[model samples]
Target: MLCLYNFIRTTGTLKKQPVYVWMWFTGFIFFLITYLESYLWLIPYFRNNIVNDLTIQWKSYGSMVGSWNMLIYGCGIYLMDKISGTQTYSYSKTGFAIYFLGLFNLMFNWGHHIYTVPTHGYIKHVSYLVSMTELLLLGRIIFLWRRQMKQNKKHIHQPGFRFYAAADFWIFLTLVLAIAMSIPAINVYTHGTHITVAHTMGATIGINTFLLLAVVFDQLNPLIRKIKNFHRYLLPGFRICNISLFIFWISLIVAGIMKAWWQVHRPEVPFSTMMISLRPYFMMFMITGVTLTAGMWMMLLPVVKQYFMHGMHAKKRMELLYKKRNASLSTY
Candidate 1:
């Protein structure tokens, strides 16, 4: 449907937005393939041959994840250009570099996810190398952004900017965690632990969620301006959410490390005992989850109300304007 729409509505415009359209199209193909394979072949096959087929399914799952990343990373590229307010970002060499590198990672880094699967040593090594290359681009972006932020202190307050900023911070922090986790030695202990959970959460919530929110808030900027003192309501929730998120993120990491250590060092310990030991971290997770939920509700409620109000006003204005236009046309 989207492809057909793009073909009809965006036939002449693809050149102007090459990277955007390409990523969207490629992601769509990947999603279709992944979905079909999972439903038609992978699941039933796994059920039939539960023992010998696990490794292949693990690899397949990685590629399945890789497929959707095209969509998410495409969003990241689009958001970067949007936030920077420059047409050049997506067109530049740096942009192409980031895009292709991301593509490469999407295709091959699935190996890293299955590092503990007793695969060839080379598979793990190659995936580690590809994964490390990502940090290079990430570092350059952070450096450039820090330099820009130092020069202009005003955009920091914009909700969109703040969200993007949070995403950048997450990229840095998550990259560090990911790099450490990618090591074969580290993967030995942390492979199935909450640390892996932390990595997944960091990527989904920290990076992708922030980027999407930044785009959403940016799109809503006009609506926000029409509302009186909207910032006063938004800023507190934003701060609370991010601060709690940071604390929440750290707690997960600490919990993961503790769990990994206990499982390895004290294999004799009962599963119940381990759960008891991890109760404090779980409690922290619950508290932070409540905070996150409250913060999001607080932030989104006014935005939703204002959006509907503005939409109604816009509809009425457009109707009146059309009526006036028709009257003027009749006079002519």
Candidate 2:
């Protein structure tokens, strides 16, 4: 559907677009097929088969996740192009390099997730190496992006740009944690630990979700600017939502670390005892979740209402105009 929309809006074939477009288009196609296979075949196959080894299951699941990342990364490309006001930005060699690296990770880097499975040692090591490369590539991308943003500081703090920047920060932080966890020596301790949970949480909440939201707010920014006092609400809402999310995110990391430490270093400790120890972090997560939710509701509620009302009223006006035109035509 996305590709179809792009084709409809474009002057020519999708092949005429930049390299990143092809990368994402292929990913989108695969994502649809993967989703179908997962629902129609994979789940039932797993259920009926009494498979002892979970290596295939876990590894495939990880790659499936990587598959969806294509959509997110594609959105990131679109958002970046929109923000920078450049059509060819995604075709730059640097951008092409990142896209291929992302494609590599999508297909292969998922091996790290199965390090704990009874897989070959070399497989795990190779995955670790491939996983590390993502961090370097992402870091370079962000460094160059930030340098550009610095040169154009006037637009840096715009609501959409702010969300993009926040996503970059989250990407950096998640990559660091992921790199640390990818070390086989460290994975021995962190696998199946809260630390692993932290990595997933950061990637989902910090990077993908943030970037998607940035795109949403960005597309809405023009409409918002036309309304009086919208920025007054939106600016503060952005701050509150981001602040609460950071707290929510960090709290998970803290909880994950504590859980991993007690599980490994104090194996004699009861799980209940560990849960009791982790109660504060859980409480913090709950509080921040509420704050984040409330802040988002407050921020988006008015905008959503206005959007719907405008659409409906516009439709009615068009309908009335069409009726009047028909009546005049009948009289003529």
Candidate 3:
């Protein structure tokens, strides 16, 4: 209780972007459904019920959350639309690609939930393909983004702590992402479990961290510039978290991949058996990351917004984006 009170106090006002509000609402809905399925749903359904009912319930909730997650995909489209309508400082094609790919990865993650559910047959197979498609989409997005950036040979090339910090994150995200995807290929030959878990952590959960890191670093530019020798002072912390993000992304991707493959190959194994296998890794990539990452985000965004939203620079940018764009439209 005290902790919650302190959290709320220190966190201060969390500015609710339209997208952020929708995410909270959807997240709460998903949590409620998860709680019911994991706890309350069992008792009522098990009243002279069989495993079939459980599978049905699982599918139902999976569908529910999956739908909510899909709505987030719609939010990505919203982001896309906003970016397109503006001419000033739009996401580079590369940024747009990464943004879209993030959406693709999330879609499959939802599919993965349904795939593991029992009695989920043809539907599961379809979901698997879609999920795999998500992976391919993500891989392509990253690949293309980098390649196009190289071809275009354009960047602001600014010298600042935030610049270096952002560079560190992207570098880490790229390197770990490569290793994460390769773990499955390596496992096919050597069949090592240790590497496999590391892969999942990197891919799924780590990607989440990287995404958040990118958002934070991008938004932190104003704050970063305000500090003295911000780059030098920030490097140690940036390196530490970037490394953590890299590893976590590695662990998550590997974990999600290995778990999926193991389930497909060994359906007879109790689901709990496989899930238990993941619990330890999940502790690092899932629980701990979620706690710190979400808390930090919910806490820090307020401060960042204060910094980001202030001054003539922001007003100029907003005027360029919304006002100028709208004014031009009127002239047209």
Top candidate, metric TM-score? 2
What is the TM-score of candidate 1?
0.85
How many pairs of residues collide in model 3? 22
* Candidate 1, position 110, lDDT: 65
Query: lDDT of each model, Cα atoms only?
Result: 0.76, 0.75, 0.48
Could you tell me every candidate's TM-score relative to the true structure? Answer: 0.85, 0.87, 0.44
Can you write out model 2's per-residue Cα lDDT over 1-332, one digit (the tens) per residue?
Answer: 77646744662567557765766666766666645544433465555653323655555667677767777777877888877778776778777777788777876687777776766777777787898897776568566886856844866655677667777778778888888887878877777766777688778877887788788878888666666777677778777887888888788888888877887799999999999999999999899989888877767887788788779999999999999999999997
Clashing pairs in 2: none
By lDDT, rank the candidates, best first. Answer: 1, 2, 3
Question: lDDT: which candidate is best?
Answer: 1
**After superposition, which runs of candidate 2 have C-alpha atoms over 4 Å from their true positions?**
1-16, 36-53, 145-152, 329-332
Per-residue lDDT of 1-332 in model 1, one digit per residue for the tens?
57646654755555666475567666776666656655543456556764335545555666677767677667767766666677686777777677678778766676667776665777778888988887886678677986767634757756677777778778888889887887878988887888888888888888888878887888888787777888777888888888878878888888899889988899899888998888999899889988987887777888899989888998999999999999999997
| Model 3, CA-based lDDT | 0.48
